[model samples]
Target: SIRLPTPISKPDRSYRVDVYDRPQLAAFMDAVKDKYDNVDQYHKLAYLRLLAFTGIRNGEARALTWSDMHLDRDEPFIDVNKTMSDNTGHGVVINPPKTKAGSRKVMIDAETANILKRWRAIQGQALMRRGLPSNVVWTNQRLSGRISSNQPREWLLAAIRGTDVPQINVHGLRHTY
Candidate 1:
């Protein structure tokens, strides 16, 4: 008979914990801006800015949509409600966050807000050029209604190649947050 190792009592214990310093994250964002000049560049730099400022998880950042953003409302916050989890190597599925607080709203600073506005304009044009549906704020190359988080991860990785920025996983930005 095969013997199994004793199970950990707390299944939810976090296995890895990495803390990011502000200067390191700032340098990464600077590198991103210096390397590219397009919507992908804006998306990544702004995403890093949001992660550094908000301290949210990578999955939360990947799952973000325009519907979650309220720039002029009384709250003027981002609602982090849903997340996407990898379903093997094929794709991902949208899931509710772990807690109500995990689904809470995060306030945006002015600098980050301005970056987002520019990104939105560029994204809008890209979507229009792709012939995507008007109501869809995000889409994949196919002009699908919504883009899966995996696609962005892959794109960011490709974009970061040959750049000075460290080869950190796309989730590293979220970890910085």
Candidate 2:
């Protein structure tokens, strides 16, 4: 019988927690909002705001549809019951939550809800112009499909290019929240 060698354990294993402090978060949010003021940039603002405020996974946010949002309710909330998995051998696919807790409804603040409302209106107009139905909350500008998973990261990098705030990935925004 052959004996396998024991796995080696490192004594010093420290994980870096990348998150923005309160003031830094405020600065980042302000920078994101101010960096893009054009009519076409509304979706980006809405996406960033949702990530910063909701603490939901980036994939979950990408999976959000107009049907999952309840902005008109007395208590506005988002149903984070699904996620988009791009790792499938075939391509991007939508799937239900792996855990029961993952399918929870996250209540959002009025400000965030209002931002979404404005985005919906802008998106509705854009869809109407193209004779498309109002479905996804965020979609590719050039393409009619949903925005790619890398879009939020690209947007974050662009927004924080010259800012003093430490650079973090899109998931870090959720950690910040």
TM-score of each: 0.70, 0.88
lDDT of each: 0.65, 0.86
RMSD to true structure for each model, in Å? 5.6, 3.9
lDDT of 1 at 155: 52
lDDT of 1 at 117: 74
- Report the Cα lDDT for candidate 1: 0.65
C-alpha RMSD between model 2 and the true structure: 3.9
Clash total of candidate 2 = 0
Q: Candidate 1 — number of clashing residue pairs?
A: 1
lDDT of 1 at 118: 80
* Model number with the top lDDT: 2
Evaluate residue 158 in candidate 2 and report its C-alpha lDDT on the 0 to 100 scale: 89
Residues 41-138, model 1: lDDT tens digits: 56666665666677677677767788787766654678889886778875767789987777787887777777777877877887778766544334
- Count of steric clashes across candidates, in order: 1, 0
